[model samples]
Target: MSWWGKVAGGAFGFMLGGPLGALLGAVLGHSLDKGMKGMEGAEELGPGDRERVQTAFFTTVFSVMGRIAKADGQVSKDEIALAETVMREMDLNVEMRNTAINLFNQGKADDFPLDEVLDQFRRECHRRNTLIQMFIEIQIQAAYADGRMDGAEEQSLLHICRRLGVPEFAFRRLEKMIRAERHYAGAGRGRAAPPPSKPTLNDAYAILNVNADATDAEVKKAYRRLMSQHHPDKLVAKGLPEEMMKMATQKTHEIRQAYEQVKSARGI
Candidate 1:
């Protein structure tokens, strides 16, 4: 069966036991219980398992995003727009879009179980660091939607990283890359006129999480590691949702651009 079908068929029967499952059950209502009987023997981490993980990822992403949005006790218009932008980027169909919206709303609820949801999501990822990292990046993007990561949002992000087993240094590196990307993208859009010099060189190094004076071999290693981590096909096989492949694709593009820029500058 298709991933979506698997997710729909087993989401309730399989997930109804957990906090996230309870939220989904509430949102999906009677429909979630319709196929509970047929969802047996679908627990292996094969294709069906991948679908299940992907579904979990999708659900956890928006829900946690909502939680982060509400961390400041007020969800800004920019944050809402960012959620909408993600929906649009994923190009979710009506049913899936509605599901995402519901999940997001559930996340914003005062009683949302952030720790429980993160624990479940971490288990779903099966120790796949790349997937966890990607999850963090998405949250960071949403946190910065209002042009800065507020104090509450930063605290929330730190908690999330700790739950996901991401180191503080790694999170800092990601933050730098995110900031650089926003700057680079803004420049590309002509949002403001450029100064005499471009920020490409510095931004490139930041994207790679390497210092400007890093050795050639170190730069190559970072590039290769990032490429492997963000490779869309690899991530998909490891349970990244098809709908979210765009994120992996864009990440790879940024890494490639950074590597190219570094190579040109260093005469490599």
Candidate 2:
């Protein structure tokens, strides 16, 4: 089966509802197959297993997307209609359709704190960079579902992408797509510039606890400190759990990148 089918099937078996179960399943299933492979021989997973992971990943991402669609005060029927259109395009089955409804309902819940909801997704996404990218892609899809991408949706997606460590170049494509959709909607928009470097090299440096003018020694110190913090194993042990190690791994990548950038700029 396809990714959505696999996730919905695995999730439908749960009594607690599909979103939470699918999210957990997607994390564990992907973690077991992707990150933890070295524990044994690391053979590739079969197609069935891969399908399960993809579905889980897609469902989790869209579930969060559903939440974000409703974040700006009200969930318009137009948005709901758009969401269904995307689902149909993806060829989701009855169970998946029901699951998506449940997830959308979950997003509409009164106590739903979007940041925490996104945080949970961030951790799960941090476990796999590709999955993180996919999650953002789905959010963009949901934002464009209503035949236009609003500024509010774009801003929310930016925040989500930043928290999930989505690279700026990847997001640029999204910006273009959104702008194009806006124009098509007769919203009267200009082309989107490249996303600003709001959370890139500088943010990475901040994560390392260093300033722009730090001495080499200070930079090294910050690098080591962040290395310790960003270490995948350390993050896994510190309640981030191994399923979400992608975030830690991304942090480590950012730390190394920051060090290199600093070294290059300083002529060290």
Summarize candidate 2's per-residue lDDT along 1-268 as a digit string, tens digits.
4344333344322211223443434333553233332333212223223333433454455567667677676776666765665555445557566656666666666664556556644443336554455456456756765555678877778877776777666686545533333322232211122223233445544544566777889889878865775576753343232333553464466557667766777789
Which candidate number has the best lDDT?
Answer: 1
Model 1 gets an lDDT of 0.79
Error of 1 at 25 (Å): 1.4
In order of appearance, the predictions have TM-scores of: 0.88, 0.48
Q: What is the C-alpha lDDT of each candidate?
A: 0.79, 0.52
How high a TM-score does candidate 2 get?
A: 0.48
Error of 1 at 70 (Å): 0.8
Query: Model 2 off-target regions past 4 Å?
Result: 1-19, 22-52, 113-128, 178-268
Worst 10 residues of 1 by lDDT: 188-197
Given candidate 2, what's the lDDT at residue 247? 39
The predictions' CA RMSDs to the true structure, in order, are 3.6, 12.7
